[model samples]
Target: MKGKISLDLTEGSWTASGGLTFTKASDGRTLRFTGAHGDLAQRSMLVDATVGDEATLPVDLSTYELDMTKITVTMPSVNSPGSVEGRPFSTTLKPDGAAVFSRAFGTSPVPTGSSLATLAGRVDVVPGLG
Candidate 1:
């Protein structure tokens, strides 16, 4: 998750550019996303990090001071013009450092509503790590 990013909560959008990688700690299988471009905002973030080998999943984002959760969401579709009770998530990612069907997914603690956003920039994503 090293690179540059711009967030616009008012617009409910975000953009990212950098390198991303997903590592499977159980077997040391790394899925790297190079020259990554991320998208996130509101309650949902779409990331298209290229997958590869040799990466680390046990990453500590707390050191970056960037909190993905508690992000401002102002979408009218969610039935809650604004709320921080939910976060973006992905239901995709294979056990072999790959994503299934679509490179898209959503997270848990769902607010039982609708959401969408972009986290622009290259980012490392570990399944179940967030």
Candidate 2:
């Protein structure tokens, strides 16, 4: 649940343009999403993602299992001029064993911990457990 996530940036094809210009500003650049490699760790629940695309993974968040619900995307700030931050978004798991995740900014997006209370059902089950 709590660990470092490293994205394989080399595997994906990212396009870079320019940043804002006009007055004391560099040309605004846009880094679009391309591809990804999820769940690097064998114990972790990995999910592959792409730009303009969405993916879902059944993460077992119970009993300290490795579950990756989202990604931490770092991008240049358009509003703040120059900065970056975590943009956690929605990740839903369906009753039919399907999980749906999204990344709007085309960057690494993390799962919303606040909305994961219900998603904590993918834990491992013991053989003799009732």
Candidate 3:
């Protein structure tokens, strides 16, 4: 079986119930998720970054403290429970490259409860010699 790598995140559900969790789904690569807050930030973070709209994300594989060629994600829903609004949401990676999804609906102030305004995405590391 192939190893998987990913990062997960959540909002509102931090103290009592909800929270984000980032893990390597496949042993493809190692990723990190750093946000403004611990909880209201990303509950879980992964590569395989997918968006729900047609947006463009900047790619620079020379700053993330890592190295890579391409970064893709599963398009996020603009109108969903944990979707984000606005087009072109970006991320700053380390050692290598970065990516972002736009028109998200979960990038706003989170509400209170186990359920929160969520923004989920992923990043896929192009096969490379590690």
Say which candidate scores most in TM-score: 1
Highest-scoring model, lDDT: 1
Residue runs of model 1 more than 4 Å from their true location after superposition: 1-12, 25-27, 33-42, 53-130
**Full ranking by lDDT:** 1, 3, 2
lDDT of each: 0.32, 0.26, 0.27
- The Cα RMSD in angstroms, rounded to one decimal, for candidate 3 relative to the true structure is 19.9
Candidate 2 worst ten-residue window by lDDT: 120-129
Cα lDDT, model 2, residue 95: 22
Model with the higher TM-score, candidate 2 or 3: 2
Query: Residue-wise lDDT of candidate 1 within 1-130, one digit each (tens)?
Result: 3322233332233344566554555654444443322223323334444324323332111101134563543433434332232244333222222231122222222222222122222233222214
- Superposed by TM-score, candidate 1 places the C-alpha of residue 12 at a distance from the truth, in angstroms, of 4.1
TM-score leaderboard ranking: 1, 2, 3
Give the per-residue lDDT digits (tens) of candidate 3, residues 37-111.
222233232332223322423222111111122223343344432222222333333221222311132222222
